[model samples]
Target: MVSLVCTLRSHQDDVNCCAFSGALLATCSADKSICVYSARDFSELPFSPLSGHGYGVHYCCFSACGQYLASCSTDATTVVWSMDTGEIEAVLEHPGRSPVRVCAFSPDSSFLVSGGSDGTIALWDFTSRTLLRTGAVTDTSIVACSFTPCAQLFITGSTYGDLRLWDLNMNHLHAEKNAHDLGVSCCQFAPQIMKGTDGCVQFRLASCGQDSLVKIWIVSLLSAAGIKMQLAHTLTGQSAPILSCAYSADGQMLVSGSVDKTVTVYQANEGVLLYTLNQHDRYVTACAFSPTAPLIATGSMDKTVNIWMLEDGSGAQGKSLPDEAASVLSSGGRKSSGHSRLMVSEWSEEDVLAWLREEGLEAVIDMFKSNNIDGEELLSLTKETLSSELHIESLGLRCKVMKKIEELKMAPVSNGTPDEYLCPITREIMKDPVIAADGYSYEREAIESWINTKSRTSPMTNLPLQTTLLTPNRTLKMAILRWTTCQ
Candidate 1:
């Protein structure tokens, strides 16, 4: 049940890659240009068809914030463009001066790496737009590269049929010599990390190859013997070489394009093929999933990019987060439930608990949890039900709880808390705000998780931390407490 919503026709030559951020979709092609389009309606941006590359553009990717885009080209350089002005931010020449084949940004948008045909990899300090370091892989061309969710190690795939893992200092950690017989075409690490029993860390990565196979592997860190990679699944849906593969934002689904002129979507964990799309007339070169929408984009040698909507059991269209955010923007800062905000009726059980804890209503937390009360349940609560059902004998307590609920209903859904009240590490409002050495405040748990991952860098600056010490931000905490009380 895959249906093509629209076909983009901006590229005059073969489209090499297509990437989507939360709000924008960008496509690179052999036409020596890149086009930017609105993810909402597929309308071209006014500054699109960016033509700065001297040679053909091969790949493009967006930063985590969707504020910038990086594109690699046969011109032996990677160009970073600002999404705000659609202007070039910086041009990084490949170290070996070899034609740059691929590029990837760290999850935190602190670092950018470009892979070159000469097996040279250049890492850039994204904050300063300067080269941090360079390293070489096998003699063969470096074609694919991606960073793990931790942002500590990265995997590179080369035409030599090896996938090598390396740390930030360009130190070789591990290598899989037989990753693909003919050579790896593309590789991507899943966005989400899973914790296993006994404090083990797990990551999943999917790679497509010229051997006409898509392989998924389990990457384990903190293993007794060091890092480990185990083959998890091998999928064979395309008859010809699989060129590109990508995981959906949630990492539940995978999609790949192939020389067979088709795109295959799979249930990643189960290795089950969900759909085989055949809209492209020529070889399918690239494929990507929208991070904020139930949509997939595929590019082909036919010089077109096709957008497909992922429908659920029902045929109703699910709105993209960017579209909702755009609505909020158009309405003059009414704001959308992008991250810092959630509608009263849309809060999860945990969100409700967070609210209760912030409002000093912890005595009723156990009761609310036991009853499985959620956002929807909270809205329907009345003073009568509170006293009779929950057996709240204190009239003042019931009135206070009801007052908080009333404030929730009357206030604009997006008007939850000030952005400063939220931790930079996690978008949610901070319960325990602590000042880090980087001079930024973050939630205790979030910053601790960031440090435990050994990223050991400021999530805000992407620079090395001078100290791991976290000081309590009592003043800010008190201010948040006062604001909540007023609300």
Candidate 2:
């Protein structure tokens, strides 16, 4: 199996936010500087370090085309930079005691949005760098905000656990209320799917605070004044407080990184936990789904950044690797027959259906695929269609299903590795602790699979492992690690 790949040593201080423009990665750091690095290689050094924020740069993002970059900071300022010239185009300064907590460019690239500590959201014209609109609700700081794909709507999450929607055209408040039990951390609008179909506008937002839970909200309400949106559904539960979340370009998958030192993927609407990325050595500060690829890039307090891909049922063997690293992705442990059955039932939806479809029974499988059909033959179908276009979702699903099938069809419910069980790497026991792209080691591929398995299938990956720092004087050690690895 190939292991996940990570480009180390990209930032100096904590990397608060990350965005991509083509092959370039724009990162904001607490060191009060923003660096643009070649996404292709970190060893090459930054293209340039644009410095200006008086304090730590809080957040940074790229324009749709990636030609421009935007960064906001505790300095109460947001600066715009042109990647081509490596120069600052605009400096946004607002009056108030609050820091410019968050800033974002509208999808259209015509405007930018910034929310501050005083609970105010400002919309600005990029060309004029002038404030166009403002929405003030709670007195608490507005922590997260995003403009919908269409650019007419904006949503903000606050320290009070409430979320508010604003109307850009009307300059009015549209919707407001608590989105979770605690302060909200991040909010994101789903990409527009189906070229022309605007069914129900859905936005997936994640909120966290003292509460370790990460709640997902689907908004459908629209403001009568001009904005349109409605609250639909929410999903909760994370090993730690979630700090950030992003949806892949396709919108079929969402990646969330948390203070919990792990990253988890959730099905947008169903709120199913597809995988638990237990790899970071410290709290994950930021995560961004690649705009055009299957990669999920994560930054953490551990002073490292990792790039991971969602795998189908294939196993750890597909992970990029060395012989010593080959076994990490395929690692597994004592089999829990009952749990295995549940996991296959839950995480195997995409796999099961694809198998049935290949067998000419596509329309007959239930949503869960739990019917008592001939299990062995059905699994073979998964292997057959894994590489074909008819199969959907990420390739990770196929890999997962294929593994479970091998276990179910060949062995009894014992801890012993089945006769067909072969490490995708060494083709041996997923022994000697497999390390994931995120940096932590897994007991076995099955263990990682179980933890990362779709919640609908495996539910839980075995009581969750305790995450502790690998170094003494963790924070200082991380700073040094970041500098060394990145340089």
Best candidate (score: lDDT): 1
Q: TM-score for each prediction?
A: 0.65, 0.61
Query: Please, what are the lDDT tens digits per residue for candidate 1 over residues 315-403?
Result: 22222123222121111111112322666677888888877765558888887887778888999999998888877788978887887
Which residue ranges in model 2 land beyond 4 Å of their true spot? 42-46, 169-173, 193-210, 221-233, 312-487
- Candidate 2, lDDT over the whole model: 0.59
Cα error, residue 391 of model 1, in Å, equals 77
Task: For residues 1-487, write the lDDT of model 2, one tens digit per residue.
Answer: 1244554443444677777666676777665768776665433222356777766687888888888898997656788888887788888875443467798888888888898766767788887889777667555777788887778777788778876777776355555555566677887777752221345444555444445666655555433434334444444546667788777776676677788677777766666666666666678888887776566777786545666656566433112233344122211101112333332334345555544443233444552254443434354556456446234354655555455355444322122333223232222322334433334333354434533422211111111244422222344334434533542
